[model samples]
Target: MLTPTPTIEKPSNLVAFAFLLIAFLTGIASSFQLPTLSLFLTQEIQVSPAMVGYFYAINAIIGIGLSQILAKYSDKMIDRRKVILYCCVLAIGGCLVFAFNRNYYWLILLGTTLLGLGSSANPQSFALAREYADNTGKESVMFSTIMRTQISLAWIVGPPLSFSIALNWGFDWMYSIAGLAFLFCGLIAVTLLPKVPRKKMEQNTPLQAPSNNQKSVIYLFITVFMIFNCNGMYLINMPLYIIHELHLPAELAGTLMGTAAGLEIPIMLLGGYLTQYFSKKALIFTALWAGFLFYLGLLFFQNTWQLVLLQFFNAIFIGIIATLGMLYFQDLMPRQAGAATTLFSNAAKLSWLVAGPIAGWLAQFWHYNTVFYVSFLMIAIAMVCLMKVRTVN
Candidate 1:
């Protein structure tokens, strides 16, 4: 049941589209928090900058643990829809807490725990989509790639809309609406998604010895972790830099994020098209260069138009790695798609576990723009690590 092989007849087209909608809704719901949480911490909750970073670090830590544990047991369950439904419900509750509460203790103990568990929805949705393709005997890799685009699609509008609502009405209104997205997402999962029957449980195989490429894969994971930590720090620091340091209006931050997300879809498609002509290492190096350029722009170009233009580089820098990194792990562990994808997801969260506190301290001690400087240095480290691994396809 845990394997990628088909276990049942193909699901209906309606079921397929339902998975697509779930992916988008889950993303939009999650996206509302991604760009706005730091702002909420500073403006609504009145926390210190370091606490904002620590908040994310703690949340990511819990989220990684919960997502992995849930993913571990999902295939063992009779119906994974139950797991998705439970995660969605937890997300809704977390949003409500944000809507009404300001106590940091309650927010940390209860709020982060709920949202942390809620992080499981994303991987579970992809897992279901992968299962959708596998059981139907459709092409799974392309299917999973397309499924990921639903998230990019969501972010194109989600951040701008979330910030707009927060700016005009208040944080509470923004969060209440976000809760509704999760409500609809959960309803769709329990009502619209399929409950495919599972194969009889197979005996667990003993874990094999480390493969020859395990060392290289370990290096790749380390490099990817470092790279994403920069992104995690950027996400926490960027809005504050724009609003407090630059004295720019709050809405511009959302638009900047929206601009990058708008370009990510097309760039991902184009990169996928070009893979036959370029080695994955070559493209990854190109992305790292684009990342360096992006952070450099953030350092020097503080104006609105120039910053907006920089998102073109941002899209290329982030879009390729997000998709390819997962594929890279899948290639390294072909038999364990479940484990591979979960590891990819955990790498993202695990990065944040470290990134948040560092970003907070940097902003507190030096200046907000210093976070960009450190972000620039992170790309150099990533590029160096990339060179140590042998070339990948």
Candidate 2:
């Protein structure tokens, strides 16, 4: 079921390695920028918490629109490499702007514009990986999980290094390093990543009446959207929660995230391997519970060691859901890799759009601890939606 339809000569292991490197580089760029952003807005740039929320909300809104535009046309292109190349170039430019400019207005204007275009890089790259595996007769699910682990690998070192650089040298230095990562990644993607021949995509054409598969995809999308809403809210608010509420040092946020990322590698690999024995729906079902428990624990476990220990659950939930959710969408829309993958990624983007403002408002109005309570509630609802999709095998 996971087999890719081969259309060309099988590629060597080196091609796979090339994709892994791209994943690593892109992950590094993301790690440097994403986690550091809240702190940058709050601490250095001196934006209010509500404004910080609006910033991410704006970026997500723009990103969801632009990435949808890309998914519309990217499927028609002859070469996937060109789309990827253009995206990385845009990402580099965005990073450069972040490095130099500290003004809030300037950042929102240029940063959101270029970076929204740049956001397509992740889904596009995933599309490329799926195509390569399909065209070369590799195990698609396993290969996709392997590609994901490369991002996990990058996170293992990326977060701590990111925070260290931002703290020690400056935010400018951090963004500069992220830009360089994209530059190197772009160069490799253009030069070495193999080009798979375009397949006919009926998925891009106008749709008929909704089928069972379409209905299921809608349910799964809502499920993932809610689950990630909790995760996104946590990622956005957890640092501030720890620093201001728990009275812990700021750098500890990096350690917790890095530890969770490290744990995600093994959890993801295990999930990939478990596909042989368990249904993806079953794994996803259990993963949502794990996510709920992680947030529940977060409400109580404010200590250093307890927080570090809790990352295992974070790893279990995030690791499984991220990979399996994407594969599930791909299975539903088999011919439309770009649309399916983008749809999955878009759920996360949409969740962030909602979560950012909510997290900001809650922290500003009520208490930081309330975010965990809301996250717990969101995942419980996600579980209910998951139960609605009985069509999943």
Which candidate number has the best TM-score? 2
Report backbone clashes per prediction: 0, 0
| True-structure RMSD for candidate 2 | 3.9
What is the C-alpha lDDT profile of model 1 across 10-125, one tens digit per residue?
A: 34676768888888888888888977888999998899977886787777878878777776676566567787889889999999998999998798879888988886777777
Flag regions of model 1 displaced more than 4 Å. Answer: 1-12, 42-50, 100-102, 167-173, 195-210, 239-252, 275-282, 299-304, 364-367, 387-393
What is the per-residue lDDT of model 2 for residues 81-164, given as tens digits with 9 covering 90 to 100?
A: 788888888998999889888899988888878888886777888888898788777888899998899888988888778989
The parts of candidate 2 lying over 4 Å away from their true place are: 1-10, 42-48, 201-204, 207-210, 240-251, 300-303, 390-393
TM-score of each: 0.83, 0.89
lDDT of each: 0.77, 0.83
